[model samples]
Target chain A: MPIEDKQKPQRNDRVTIRTVATHAGVSVAAVSKVMRNAYGVSDALRAKVTDAIEALAYRPSRAARGLRGRSFTIGVLLIDIRNPFLPEVIAGVNEVLGPSHYQAMIGVSDARVQLETSLIESMIDYKMDGLILVAPRLPSEILAKFAVQIPIVAVGYHDASATAFDTVNADDQRGAEIAVEALLACGYRDIEMLSLGERQGHAVSVVRQREIGFRRAMQRGGLGSSPAIGKIPIASPKREEAMRKFLSRKDRPRAVFCWSDLDAITLLSLAMEMGVRVPEDLAVIGYDNSPTAALGLVNLASIDQSGRELGQVATRALISRIEGRTASEHIFQIPSLVSRNSLTRSGSGTDMKQG
Target chain B: MPIEDKQKPQRNDRVTIRTVATHAGVSVAAVSKVMRNAYGVSDALRAKVTDAIEALAYRPSRAARGLRGRSFTIGVLLIDIRNPFLPEVIAGVNEVLGPSHYQAMIGVSDARVQLETSLIESMIDYKMDGLILVAPRLPSEILAKFAVQIPIVAVGYHDASATAFDTVNADDQRGAEIAVEALLACGYRDIEMLSLGERQGHAVSVVRQREIGFRRAMQRGGLGSSPAIGKIPIASPKREEAMRKFLSRKDRPRAVFCWSDLDAITLLSLAMEMGVRVPEDLAVIGYDNSPTAALGLVNLASIDQSGRELGQVATRALISRIEGRTASEHIFQIPSLVSRNSLTRSGSGTDMKQG
Candidate 1:
């Protein structure tokens, strides 16, 4: 065979709408109507067009369609990718999006507000169908302003009163409360919370919500209104330093609840280095129920909020909003506790001996 | 401000390329030439157009530009998101792209070749400027075919013979040799390797390269050419089962080398569970030296390849290719061993006690 004859038909040589119309012996408008599933298309015309499409293996150009309308691409903005919890959310998003015509394009902002803003703008400029912002650090009002340009569903954001966008959260306050209650149930009287240190305490931040829950649960348990809450710096060096200081402190609490499993696992390492035994000298509970926390060596008790489920719910909500559901929905899912050896020696339930 | 006034100055009120041309008192073609940095644009014209752009805060629509030409966006394809090593590479890519006009959009292929091919096609369809595939599973010929359509730089792929695309990798064979040499220097003659089990071993894969290095190093150290190499399943239940089986085997080697820290850390946990002590009963070393390996409770000795540096180099190479660097460049960096408690009790250097 000649080289030209042997060459297979590539994407450039693909069948177009015109070819489908010609093959179906119908006008281009009729084929277009059938392709869009418009109301005016007759059953006979639809069947003819569909048969031609199947025979010709025609795939409409997404870029060309995107120039005119929806791109069928959802942009997912992640604040940071280092956390293991974020990958779980991505898995959930992919799970929900796999069967649909829609596809996801991810942008990592690295927790920088400027980069996050630029990424959102770029997504909108690309004419994406919708966006899912996972644990965004931007204020609610700013998010509301952006939501006016495109449909948005925020996962891990705590805004409930916003009318422009939907919010899906794991109920961080409830998660923190569960963590504290588990620690209290384990018969620990001297307990404190280790929280992320930030310049401002925004109501929309999950960290602040967790902190609020920690205080409320502590107060409800008859602990003083001013229970100790140590702040851990977000940077690695300072984060380790603060954990070390806490471990070496003479007045360290009998039990501690960390805002995230990332920090709690580090605390476990530091405690081991400092010769302070878990559940024997210092008990620990963390949020997020990360995979590392489940390791036999770490064995950390944690609050499981299920980031994957949050991603699934957020993607569904975003799709609905994109398809013209205007009313804002603020959905919340309660979290539960996973008991491990770090909480108590039995590793089954709370041992009710007072500290 | 009245709501009507606020609404009037929304999307439509924003500046555009035509507005920039008008503000600069230049022709639209001249402004376009200046934006593209095409020839025949005077310095004065470029300066005026830039000033106008800065004054109006005009950002050219990426979607509109994508229809005609480059989108100024780079696509990053990750085989899997769960591995900690992949994130380091992303951090490096982001670091290099942060100061440039290019932005990275990531796609998770979930280690499936079909998904990887689709994601690559989607990026090309989107008219992205370039692509950086981290540890892709695609064959060299397929990648070369895709290279005809778009610029590609593959990190962790070991195909230096390919002429179409650039590859940046840590010397995996040398990395394996370093690990084996460290183990040999500790005077352990009975050593084995735990490698990933796949349906077929491709020469382009990093795992296959590491295996070759492991065999060569074992033979150089006067060990028999048929040294024991255990194959570990990649999936969860079976993976652990394989490690547990190896740990309990009466004829197991005195020391072992693992393909990755992900498996090594798990093996350590299972070793503790099975009443086998590290270094005393079975010395172990791993690759990648991931952050988890550095944890005090799970300090596994391993080779450090610096995935972040590989990412940075790959991004630079991709950008250079996108900017018209035609020659295919293959870059390699050497990896070193990080001694830890898993290899010896001292956690400083190898304990040269013969076994």
Candidate 2:
């Protein structure tokens, strides 16, 4: 490498709009509009400015913008910020946002429609450029209507209603089947499941698809009678109480697959309280592979959908939408089952049980 | 309870920006500028506009402003999204942000300096109003310069200087002493410590204080004759290979305290690989009480600085700074130990001599 070739480029310390305009052969006002993604730019001019920006590896100075349009904030409204699964998804969102000059601000809606409504209102009030909703329980009408105004991505909702915002979700049915298959492979026959109930009776709802898949997998395995399902209201931590009735039954399930690791953890704690030995009298598997599930006492067997991957996809969807793409529908991400110590014995008397 | 009251609220929703502008006797542009937090607004006019905004409950639609100044996004950057300790800090942050009408967008920087720098830069470029950096590893000079331009809260860094940016970190020296004392109380005379090296000599870094605390505790206990500290670079897994040399030694300590639960986990995993029984052969203690430390197989006894509480404190500090609190200095958070299964059965029988 010659010294002349490697010489420092001209001082573009704060790459000025003038430099870009000069390079692209356009007015500074035109360049400014392009930077703001404003209207009235010819497609050819936009392309020329963009190409110049890339070629120069230009990074616009946010300080000079004076808290104006270039602060690169991406708003993330989590249904529940404490929910273990959302962390991974946010991580994935960060992966996409990292390169695109965006940072995410997260809000915990606590799965309340009203709180979420206020939170989104606040995000909009604050002027976030983009928003992501994780497994929101809100009506699709609100989401669809909102999409017309701001770039939005909904994660964990599989069905793509044209009106609802762009979506990134797992094949809940396939994930459910995989959960059932894991139990069957471990020699389970009487495997039950626990899940959340659908709010608006949509096929795209994760809870509904997972429940259906569980039923289908059981039926296909020659079990005419479907396994029992417990659909309880979320945030009602009476899991120990609710699970007691199921555990006290005569024909109990050898294993129970839960929709979330939190429930399974509660169940395990409850079972221990009830003196039910794990992987002996009963076995438990859960979803989300939550960080809490990996805790020593919980050690839940879970399905790994990689919420981060979902977040990454959803972010990409929103970026695509932000970039003026006209077409976006349902995006079904795949989920994998992580075989931890939580799920081992199945259908009773299986020696593959972990130490 | 009557529908009449609801009807009145619906009437309130009818209050538009134009209505506020007309009421405040200002041009719509002036109101818009106040709403956008743009410069050049006189305090008197700003107060007048703000009063009108509050009275009318005039919310600027996120849709219309989607292309304008306020993206309404707040960014949270963390070293790793998966750290079990962070949720609590985030929980606190949400508590503060939720009511103040700010939404948080989180990015996982994977504890990398370059990644964190880029994430911060990108967030700034996108128009984020403020940022919270959790356990960041960037240089102070870079951070100081960045803080001069943007509102930043640096959590988990204990800087002695009045500080260029707001910071919150635990008293690691005291925290380390508590761990040592707990182990000493358990009668572990020959105790060892597992820690990371003093990398890059960052004054505000955590490990250095922890080591000082450990050494001081040993000296206080009259065990400073041979301070057995095992250094490991957890930044890379290859360095984990050092655990055996310390574990298999003839003069091995009966109880070992670690810097973090991750270190404890790696030690335990290596112990299992080396066929060394836990608690029975050696007692281990760790810090952070990370979810992984509490797993079924690795019930590590550790300190809980409460990442959640730290996050809450840091958020409050940042908010104070944003609200113009010029007198505040760096905050040193206190920590408490959470003893679990790892720090058991030390100084009994011939544990140390036998090893």
Interface Cα root-mean-square deviation for all models? 9.5, 13.6
Off by over 4 Å in 1: A1-61, A347-355, B1-15, B22-26, B42-48, B347-355
DockQ, structure candidate 2? 0.21
> Please, what are the lDDT tens digits per residue for candidate 2 over residues B146-215?
7765578888776657456888888999989988998898788888888876467566667767877898
Clash count (model 1, backbone only): 0
DockQ of 1: 0.30
TM-score of each: 0.91, 0.77
Fraction of native contacts, model 1: 0.45
lDDT of 1 by residue, A114-160 (tens): 99999999998888999999989899889999899899999999889
Task: Give per-residue lDDT, candidate 1, residue A300.
Answer: 88
Instruction: Give candidate 1's whole-model lDDT.
Output: 0.87
